[model samples]
Target: MTNPTALELISRSNRLGADPKNTNYAGGNTSATGTETDPVTGEEIQLLWVKGSGGDLGTLTEPGLAVLRLDRMRALTNVYPGVDREDEMVAALDYTLHGKGGAAPSIDTPMHGLVDAAHVDHLHPDAGIAIATAADGEALTGTIFGDRVVWVPWRRPGFQLGLDIAAIKDANPQATGCILGGHGITAWGDTSAACEANSLWIIDTATAYIAEHSSPEPFGAELTGFGALAEADRRAKAAALAPTLRGLVSTDSAKVGHFTDVPEVLDFLSRSEHPRLAALGTSCPDHFLRTKVKPMLLDLPADASVEDSLARLQELHEAYRADYQAYYDRNAVDGSPAIRGADPLIVLIPGVGMFSYGANKQTARVAGEFYLNAINVMRGAEGLSSYAPIDEAEKFKIEYWALEEAKLQRMPKPKPLATRVALVTGAASGIGKAIATRLAAEGACVVIADLDLAKAQAAAAEIGSADVAIGVQANVTDEAAVQASVDAALLAFGGLDLVVNNAGLSLSKSLLETTVADWDLQHNVMAKGSFLVSRAAAKVLIDQKLGGDIIYISSKNSVFAGPNNIAYSATKADQAHQVRLLAAELGEYGVKVNGINPDGVVRGSGIFAGGWGAKRAAVYGVAEDDLGKYYAQRTLLKREVLPENVANAVFVLCTSDLSHTTGLHIPVDAGVAAAFLR
Candidate 1:
């Protein structure tokens, strides 16, 4: 068996784009320009050629190849929006190559250019697509190549994609090829034959797996106990789920269009078991961010009442919101605000498929995609044999993760809170500063309200050059000032989606030394101040019917009352309880209330600085630094807690990811208190 030559490998690569069984006219091309060394120095150099956009790789000839200088391609990364415009990319390619007549370069030219290898081949193989879209794609890849493969999540192909590959190359420095999720694969090597062989190997692996386990049995046979519903009954069920969904979704594009042509839609919707439909996802994870974890499961009874259906939907939505809030609060750092919202959950009418209500198209799309993919994976896994998705704790970690949250913060498309207003109290430092910074970064017009107006302004200015942060002077405990501040935030940001109640003081006075006046002061700042802010935020969160987060920064002292701090400890305890009561009462109106109880946060602001740290240190007969060391050593993880650690927890609780959590107190104490309690 003779090995294929470089020209033969290029021919095979070009032919892959034309295979209908693989990519169906999604535009693919391949190219090969022979090596070119300096004429004077005789140094080894490579001249690359890529297939033009409209030219089919299968039929591509030398004329279809666009020759270019690899050095010039590498330099384009410095240009503004270099990867954004296709024309600019092509124009840049023209500057380096000398060719009489060759096809345009492949859109993936920059990616291939980054590879140090002599030969590169790019293809969107059908088998690769199947594996990439599978439920355990990442896990599957790991099993296939232990450490040889690198996976890149889906991103629009071109300059940006090239830059991403370049970074990966720099990191790994020895990677063979890269797999782009939901897109395709690229293989490169010292020679064209090696690159082609690698590409063929990946496709062969995926193909073999698909052939062995492509089809799995369904979840279950038709419900034997419950009789199948008639066509009219199915339509009634669909109607019942639709109106509630109307309230939850912003657009009716996916809803208005009926699945008259798709038999799967009709068959699924007609089934009495509505939960089964949630198993199908659109295609990928990016889609899930727009949709949700899951869609509504509407089981329409033959004689079901509209009110009953609506009530059920409302009940589930509330439950989900509560769960989301609780997750956020638990994982949030000390001094962060709580998660709040109404209708973050969406409904998928049995017949309607999926519908979501977000502030805009991108939000709706994100929810739709997430819900779709999750459902598909869940259902597909069920077919394979009763597979359960990751647990709530794990899901919460991903959904409320700092890195994931940062991604959203970085390239915010359109969000519900993009144009919305927000007010953050205690914004001068600690958790309050974090919340203010996050909200501003996410495109919200924010008002930083604090007792120390100058400190608030300084904090705001430090975040960014933009005037997204407005510092206002207002004692959160003062009713008049609270009202005026809320008014100011609303007037400044246009509307509100969040209010962080994070102002308070703590005093470590033993019961004997704790005066009535001292207790009142602690209660006024922590408890009373929270109420004033909530009452003020309610006007906007409720009146707008837009729903919002009301986050209270309580203390871990609330959960584990330390010795000689009766006033501060009691106030924090009350704040946690208050959140539960508020969640129950305000849940009906779409307002979410939650709290964070962080332990062992270093003294920077609030009660920790106002003699409380010294007093608590005195109880242990240690200096303040020693107290930190004591707490750090006592924890299971043996890590000192930082304000940012607490800030991370607060950020998650307040974000939309934990849309279902509310009415809970999360301990952000690095497991110290939990160890003690246990």
Candidate 2:
């Protein structure tokens, strides 16, 4: 069990970090000085546990906290009159670790040590940074919090900064907190609860201060004339254009993903002054590490094809990368470690949305979350007057700092499907969700396409890291929406490798009871949806001259006759035959086309979510509860056809060495001979 005080400190840290407005992804740290038994001496010694470097304080655990000897850290807190002792202080922090733990303490460990209090909390809260970055930050801090807060001017976080903090705290013995200009805020007290209270008080009071004192938005009126994509067209265009933008930023082929529609993010980007503000720079030094000192604003041509956009994006990327290196060379101090590459983490693409880049989906998500907060702070500071943070020279030291770079340099190598991209339709539930999840697990970036945008997003969130699964709203029958879905796959991941056509519906009715509407619903969704998605996917596949896979989810009724299932049977048969022809046309381009015929899959699937299972069971003269077992008993193998069973078959078709096998149907009905092909 964690010590009660330590637990409170961690609890406070996590709660603060959980909100991006407070601490954007791994941006803040916390520490608590407590007594612990020495490993060799077996005597109680004061130990300081600051948040470990590079880990998100929001999700931090016991081991994630770095334990340091408090006395040793305090010894290094004072900068000897004025020599360059930053390097020596960093080494001292390393030497002070009390035991076997190798996790490095946060860069601000020494400052936390000199707090002379039981708890110390440092956070880059949005409101705090907004106030800190403003031209009149010092004046505002005094006006907002009065005598309780000490204002520390802009300084590199090192021994000097620690000395300054210690000196200020000594001078103002009654102050409860200190605001680090162009950086963040620190609050300390005798107890964890007291320090946390002070932190909240500071944030709340400053937020209120800004709300009342800040000037009116400068560009609010100019937004009326901004050239932008229509809301109806943004999703499709964003999807289509994603690949080109991704290709521009990709160093190798790890698929780049775009995250859009976060309410706050959208609200910020919609501001007409965003381009100008973003170009100014990040509000905090840590954000400079997440995004960059210079923001890359990508222009989307009004009417450009995927090919044309890719060409244009390539040119932009080259210029952006070169400019980044020049900025780095200009500001990099001697002994600062070289960054891996000059790729921008968050790139602004007005009229569509800003995109966050990283090696994997999670890192990209961090970039997006962090940038959203940074933008809010930027807009807030600008409203207060003009946005200005630590300039490029100050930001350079933080971005390329040896300690910060070590965190990102720790990720392992990518897996097999790291470069591949896939689109799964009807992915909100059941079979489609299973297939999409499997694809993500195998390292393929997946686009979750469904009729309901919310459900699609929820399904994607459930599958894996938010970046790997993108939700796209597409009604397959609509040619435009289908084209958009295809574009979404290419645009988001830079290329396409697999297309899973699983969006479908069925109507239960007798020959006389079957209305034309019922027939159209089934036919349009099954036959036409597959046709549209396949047609769209095939064009992209053929254009690249790269092999791909198109897997269609058909029904067992295609080959096996069922009572009161005419519409489903006929349209499914249409799909089965269409797959054969698609194989013939697409096979020349090495794009394999195959079909899976699955039996009843009722558990937690959308097919049953709307009472379709109960209605279908009634038609079959079986109780709703017995529907799955009743269907299983009729099959020779007497096994229920789970959604995962169908997913496994689809995976085999897409990934198996049966490269020459196409235009064939794989049955997922537990040995139902009637559905078997001759």
Candidate 3:
């Protein structure tokens, strides 16, 4: 860690005596001031402060502290066959404090030099260390504090551990502190008091849980496996078993521990079935991030060959990998990113328990935590059941969502169009009704334009007052009627910012059997009606100079080419093209034009009547009962294209987020386009 400033030093010293975790420990240290000069950046650094040797923090003074220049100490760690002799290490520390002829610095100076945080506190709190070294410490910690604490798998302290902490801090920028698995707890904060408080809180929580869960004697019968092996042989077997166990579980096993000594460990390994032993962990989720879901359970055979054991482990790994992949594949959506390069599995050396691995410390911690929680849950559930988390497809959607990805892109602060007014045509029911509802919800005063006078008034009443909503009857195809609708909107709301061209008719008929009148009626409502409404709205929008939103409700058949629906399809296609040209012409005024093409909008009025539904279904060679299912299955998301979904698309385009977007046609078809391509 870097050295603290005068203010930081005072703050740390004050907290040192107050923090119970630091009792009897050497006085705390600080990092150097000024910028650190490194090979990467080569900048000047102040100094590094470390706890002085052989002094208790509970009663310490400034003389008990060791201050060393950060740059010189950092240079030492980079050297190969780094100085190992105690005298040499002390000499290096002295040079850091007073040049080549300076006083001696703390022995922990090298470790402090490696930390990234401005402040780092290392304590060997008795309670923390005692609990940490216990077999089921991680699980116990989780049952105590839940999401508030982070756990690091056991690693030898010094440069490597400091580097690991730096990585963990980077990944979890919000963590209050960290616990070293099989070691002790470390807390960090912007201020010394905050850090000290966090440390106390963690210890207290862990202590409470331990007091409640710990037993005078073993709570469950122990299981036996590897107690017979010699110490040297046990260590070698455990080291070799790490990879094999990891392979069996499809997780990283480098972090797993294989202890050859200790009564609890030995006794647990002696039993044929390890009961309470199943619940052990280094820490909670934070630790699991490094370790993975579960450790390898190793049960050594008295006469079994090491090769056979390794092979069995390999088979287990294969089985786990296959199952994990299957789970991921089952829940994943089309075009989603793969969940993991390899399965996040772990092996438990029966007596040794779990371990984890990652490309970095954070990854290992995350893997370890996940494995730990899963094991606790599994053990609690007993062998009759196990946790089957979300499948890969669902996970992929959440992990690789376009919306989530968009959040990564730079964006300006959002501004609300609070004073904007909107007019939605054919607002009495169906897609138009949905559009009207949505616009109102977005704080826009809306005029529900419909040809049905009574239904229009009723819809307006349902949506509330004229300030936020008004019902007006106007035949969308009639030029005068369209003008009246626009005049009403302007009169009531002052000016217009949006116009939803949702009034359209759907008629199903083969070209030969279709009457000219039927064709004209369809075109009049779907195409000509759109022109009248748009032409009327564009005048007010252009004059206001405030820009605006124009949304056209087109059908998927416009692109898919449905049979026996020639007139409706052609008119929809024309409506879409109209949007493109409108967008081009309106760009100068900052007005946006877009369209939503929906496939199956169930529960709409008139559109599904007149045998049109049956006729359309017949064209597709399926009964009406299966239409929704067919459409859903064909879609990549397997979701119905509801009117509400189309409305959502219209609402998005109408908002300021798309202020720069224009002349676009977004299909709210739930991956229909991709389905067609497939």
Candidate 4:
């Protein structure tokens, strides 16, 4: 086979990456050596095939492997002299980019060449990293694996570092594996399968040994402050804090994904020395490349009000950026890569779970997974005594390394609505959930703004994987809450493109029997709530100078009132007119405000909750059981007008497919003749 070693390396890496306990998507790398016949020369030439950078080993294939001429690659060893081998390495990776490929091989390629074995596998197994980053790692490594493994002190991985590894292995011929202090472990053998076996053996044995020796704690036992609070208080605090946090980190250009803190994370951060421990840096360089040198640790008083927390969060944003600048200034020299913005990749909030930020959901998720893994490793290392990691100087080497940053630049372009932010009122369930789900499905980062923060969170979770949604509590009728919801959308996704007013209610009451409270309730949510949300969203859209959408969920009752539905009919009529007026005003600013009027939405709606089903059945003179079927059969197409159906109409208006069409209504009631526009 032309590159069997490449295939074998891909296979072995995938095997190691099958479980998170072994290795993460972008951590570690593997390689194998063999010879490939030169196409033109017709002579055999040595080749080294290594896993390409930023590829997940779990699903890796031969196409993802990088092949290099062994003799050419080997000749570069010890050639770069004192410090900063990045230039030489980048050039080498470029020279070795195989098969008209776009990606460079893993930066650890040169190190793999030093193994002096046919196969080499480098992995950041949970147990391996935990042990490797532990205090006095060398002695501990000696005790655990004896002479079979060699320990190399913390050294930034590059061409020179590769030479050092080879030198150490050359001297200690019997050591079949090596642990790079505060990093990860490596194993090698005569064959790919043998190397795989050695890697598993080292990781499994270390894990077992650590478990037996250390007093095991919960996964996040180290985190504390947030976990100590009452459950209800914690939920409220997290909701209050998330939006402000999202806003601070978001710039006009980029909005990072916000990860809600979990109970485990709260317990872990509750640890007394968490601030210092957090700054100790990542267990592996790969993680630092994603989460940065360390997380931005936010320590807030547990009893602080939302106003105080908001002010504090803003201040923290400024301070974090300044600190990041200082760090970059200290480490960045003449030949170093340009520095990135000061926005943090991860934020540690006391009494709340951690907030991680990334430009996109995938980037955010990768960073998050690494932090969780690091926590586990750090916890184990601390139990053994102290946790140690590479210094900031070494960390800079990995962070701005052209190879490391290039992996991101080389990523595929984002989806069209990938950068847009959206807010869906009443998103905890029903029509609101359907709209939120559709927006998220189409790649818009969404905020599930509802009265029930917990339920909003659940709805966001149910929208599916990828950190595309975050829940924010907002009573739509409350002006301040509506503003907060709008702010959350702006902050979480950078800018707002869509604001959906889907929160509504209905009650069956005759004109004479309609109570003042009933009229107030209908008008407050449908009219006042829409105005609050639209005004807030419009200011943002105008300020951003980007066209956006303000969509309202109107009702057929606006034109064709149902008997004994006086309060519902009046509000629906008022709301429909409000949408038209707003559309006319916003059209001048490129913002499209429209409405979807559906007649019979008995299913997939919160309005039908309680006795509405019974009330609706009574109005139509049908049994409660026949309500859905009756509505469906009466519709023009004999179909149920669903929440999803309403959501689809909203999607069209927001996408601007009907860019020029606004100041209108889209009927989703399956052809109600009386409700149709003149």
lDDT of each: 0.60, 0.78, 0.59, 0.77
Q: Write the per-residue lDDT of candidate 4 for residues 620-676, one digit (tens) a residue.
A: 899987887898887778887888898888788777478888778888888777777
Name model 4 segments beyond 4 Å from true: 1-7, 35-46, 78-85, 215-227, 251-253, 260-264, 301-307, 419-442, 446-464, 468-498, 502-550, 553-572, 577-678
Residue 150, candidate 3: Cα error in Å is 73
**TM-scores of the candidates in the order shown:** 0.42, 0.75, 0.39, 0.72
lDDT of 3 by residue, 601-622 (tens): 6556446554666676787888
549, model 4: CA deviation in Å?
6.2
Which 10 consecutive positions of candidate 1 have the poorest summed lDDT?
A: 252-261
Model 3: lDDT of residue 605? 44
Model 1 CA lDDT for position 107? 48
Q: What's the ranking of the predictions by TM-score, best on top? A: 2, 4, 1, 3
Q: For model 2, which pairs clash?
A: 242-491, 243-491
Span of 10 residues, lowest total lDDT, candidate 3: 252-261
Q: After aligning candidate 2 to the native by TM-score, how far in Å is the CA of 587 from where it should be?
A: 8.0
Best by lDDT: 2
Count backbone clashes in candidate 4.
12
**Model 1 Cα lDDT, one tens digit per residue, 57-130:** 66665565666766666677667375335436745766766545666554467776665656766665645554
Error at 482, model 2, angstroms: 4.1
User: Residue 217 in model 3: shift from native, Å?
Assistant: 99
